[model samples]
Target: MRIRAVGTSALMIEVEDPLAWFAALDAARTDGRIDVTDIVPGARTVLLDGVPSVAALTAALRDWPPPAAASVTGDRLDIPVIFDGPDLAQVAAHVGRSPEGVVADLTGTAFRVAFGGFAPGFAYLTGLPWSIPRLESPRPRVPAGSVALAAEYAGIYPTASPGGWQLVGRTDAVLFDIDRTPPALLTPGRTVRFVIA
Candidate 1:
């Protein structure tokens, strides 16, 4: 991976692996010298957008050895969820496991807030069990605090917005509220762990 200057608008850190980019982002964000307003992390590249001189930031990133897997160790966010999703039975059938097993996998393991872009406060995570079912369609109004799953990840809907992720459960936590500072509770690169009560 190479950290190159991509004009004054942003500094592009070109990374080959998705995980490496996150590790680099985790490192750069810790250093206070470079003010990063936007850390757009992707599968290969992590883009930083800000007004500071790109030359200075680029230099700061150069020779920055990506951290080890353990260093990038994500956070655990315990999100309490219910197993009353409409697709609960179907998901269990798809994975050849009991509905209780599906519920356990979704809330028992640790996941990370890989990115936040699908919507305001909408977190995109990874490291979900692969034996889950795919979302067939979206619901017009998935109540707030709904814990949904799709593909290989799961997330909580910050608002009562239309979504496609398989309905899994709901949490009482406020993921995104404009009243709070910056309004967003989750940011990319942070870890998450779900704890069902």
Candidate 2:
């Protein structure tokens, strides 16, 4: 792990495993060990925003023990999905399985929100058994609530937008709502499971 200063008040910690670091940093902030305003997670980094003293945090981090393995300790949400997408058969073919088999495998896996990007409330989920490639040509628009997969991540489209991920299903769950206290439903560390609608 490497901690580097980002501007005046933020420190970006680059790690091989962002989830573990994120959980550790979040716990530190909650327990009053770190007076940080925000902990933003990325593909392989955790950005500590609004720190009062970067030097103090950096020194403390050096003395801290190695972070524990990250666990899905956040809210667990079961999303009801209709496993009938245009690319369902294609995904099955890529995995060398029937559509039903693919659905079974997906529903059986426990996914965790790694980070949020691409759009509001759109989370890049982790826990796929293997990596999958994106579509050669991205669709002009993917409807909201579309459950899709790309690379090593699974995600849901929070709004109708152009995307390249392979769509495998659709859901009715509200991923984002401005009125909601926590606008995004799949914040980092949350657990998600897809169930047949």
Best model per TM-score: 2
* Candidate 2 lDDT for residue 36: 96
**What is the alpha-carbon lDDT for the whole of candidate 1?**
0.72
Pull out the clashing pairs in model 1.
75-191, 76-193, 77-192, 77-193, 78-193, 78-195, 79-194, 79-195
Please report the candidate that would top lDDT against the real structure.
2
RMSD in Å for all candidates: 3.3, 1.2
Model 2, range 129-158, lDDT digits (tens) per residue? Answer: 668899999999999999999999999999
> What TM-score quantifies how close candidate 2 is to the native fold?
0.95
Model 2 lDDT at residue 187 = 86
Badly placed stretches (over 4 Å) of model 1 are: 2-8, 12-35, 55-63, 70-75, 131-134
Angstrom error of the Cα, residue 194, model 1: value is 2.3
Q: How well is each residue in 1-197 modelled by candidate 1, as lDDT tens digits? A: 67777776787776655565665565656786467777777545778887377877777667566655523353555666656777777777877889889877776676766667677888877778874555566677888888877887778888888888877677888898889985867666567777765
Q: What is the C-alpha lDDT of each candidate?
A: 0.72, 0.92
